[model samples]
Target: MAAESDAPERGAGTEKLWNETGIDPVELHLGKDSGYTLRAYRMSDTLPGAKAEEPEPDEAEDDDEDAPEAEADADAVPEDPDADEPDPADFEDEAPEDGDEEEDALDAEPEEVPVFLTRKGKLLVFREPAALVAYVRDNDDHDLAAVDEYADLQERVTEDDIVCDEADIYELDLVVANLRGGQEGWEPELLIKAAEVGRDLGYALKNDSIVSALAPGSPLDDLDEAFRVVAEGGLKGRFAKRRLKRSDPQQAAIAWRGVIAKINDHVEWRG
Candidate 1:
């Protein structure tokens, strides 16, 4: 009888504390034999604060415990710009692989696409060696291997690749024009390679001439301009003149100066 009388007073105190602290009680009902048990936690824990998060290392401080959440919330956001940034070391690591890929690509002797991009990438497209050989003679397809062997003469003969002749370069220019999609101007590397092909074939100014001819003019005039350049002296001519002069003393002073001018004329000139 005495314990039952004390229950009301205990209940009153509990109610008062709940009101003061704004904490709700969760009555977890156990088995009927166990009866019910009441547990209390801050109401915020189950209400507006349910989604509240912890702070991150880089966040600033704030008075409210919830305020620390602002920093945490910001941290959840993604930094997209940082995603695109690359490590400098990546290029160094990839360089050897890239070189190997290039060598394999070359050695694999993939059929050249005439100005058509390689499956590897856009930068690798050139006048297909087969096509260049074919351009010389229709049946040269059988002879392409021989032509390629001839083209490689620079490596064996001069320690460097020879340039392509103008006729062949013109064919390459045609191939470049036929390329389904590519930037419409001549790339210097392409010019250099064309010249190499010509040199290998024993055409003095053919490749360089073709390259100059392909230089872009107005939107519609590019192809026509290329034709003119091929007929006239293009970079190939300039390169050939310089080469001839370098090999010959009489034309050395004039030829070397011209070569310097030609080198300067091309954007690839480093010296």
Candidate 2:
């Protein structure tokens, strides 16, 4: 994506320091707290430690994440004839022919995904611009420090350059309320922006549950697409409106609530 060059003006204008730098300051409103952070998108292969391993199963989740020990109720446990010799097919797939897999891999294109100013997989946000600027200038241990654009950030940033585009300011705190308002009250701009930010956070933070919840073709994603179509306003938009009318607002609200909770758990708030 092209860097946004024309950000809406603030104090001295939407601080052009980030413009064309492939990084932008953003304000996030979650629950009752609002904070400022930095985010950027880089090619998957180009990002430091880009290929995050599949996350281990959640400790709190059952069945979906992991099953309880069979020894807990040995008397009730069903006898399994094939438990001893597990099927090889269930554990792993047959390796593809040597050069064919390599050729296809070379032909595939790398995609761009979001990365944030995180440390040890936790997002770092600041309550004050001065704090965030100081951290950026003094800290080199954070994940973003490995990116090419980060050098410019260290050399050029100041407290005044911490401005964010209005478009980049996400009000996630209000997403649940808007969703609970039902179809008539749904705000396309608000819902769409929430989805965009959630997707970025999910990938950037390596939260598999969040990624799965908002994956393409999931119910929430379908809702996002419908809202986008309705926002477009045309004959198709009328059909989309009918679709949105059938969608459950409460379900959407709950799903978003879970994603927010997961994100809040991983946030490292600073002042």
Candidate 3:
């Protein structure tokens, strides 16, 4: 009876807002700073203003046309009249093979990626829930405002509604420490959550270092996969754990620390 009484106190009423909108609140703890922000995922081709920007033509090409032409060298070798003429077939466009077309289609598929509430490529986070609510309600300039559900959220959300689920709360501060503690002391779930958020932020912030560090074949990704395997608990997991034992703990800790620092550099805290 006592635990059930904290429904509104736990912001249960506001949970539906996120559920329906498919946008979630996330609490990020960066050791020295912590804040709340909104994040969502969408297909790359479906995101607002997602069109590719074409590069402008270079002025150097035009300058070359205006410059005086170089004089032909008198000492140059004369062309042989008997030489075979170049084949016109060489310049013709070749049709792609069936397998090549299939590969192209696969490569062109739109990927789903995280998008944060941001203003001018900088994520907008607030130290206080009220300030985050206020920022959401008052500002229409951010990337989140482009969503169809954002208007509904703006009208409905309050400071109390800004409360996030425990699952969405990430304690990145503890990542490096946990890694340096060695395989036996590592917490699988914590490291998994850190990887999830790190990947999301890597996409949201479009930071090259984060993307490369957390890429599918990267060392950090390998560590994440090893932790995932250990958490599953099976014969395969046993082998994965053995592999993890052989891995260097300090190297992983350093890599994660560098990624955390890169993320910290892009953060802008309000309130």
| TM-scores of the models, in the order given | 0.14, 0.76, 0.79
* Candidate 1 lDDT by residue in tens digits, 119-164: 1111111123333223222222221223233233212221011122
Is candidate 1 or 2 superior in lDDT? 2
lDDT of 2: 0.84
Q: Give the per-residue lDDT digits (tens) of candidate 3, residues 1-271.
A: 1112232334456778888887888888888888899988877777775667655567667766776555435556799999999899998999889999998887678888787887776877789999999888888897777777889888888887876777778889999998999989999988998999999888788788898999999999999999899999999899999999999999999999999998888889898
- Model 3 worst lDDT run, 10 consecutive residues: 1-10
Worst 10 residues of 2 by lDDT: 1-10
TM-score of 3: 0.79
Candidate 1 Cα deviation (angstroms), residue 196? 8.2
- Give the count of colliding residue pairs in each prediction: 15, 0, 0
lDDT of each: 0.30, 0.84, 0.84
In candidate 2, which residue pairs clash?
none
Sorted by TM-score, highest first, which candidate order results? 3, 2, 1
Of the pair 1 and 3, which is ahead by TM-score? 3
lDDT over C-alpha atoms for residue 130 of model 2: 95
Off by over 4 Å in 1: 1-96, 111-197, 200-271
Higher-ranked by TM-score: 2 or 3 = 3
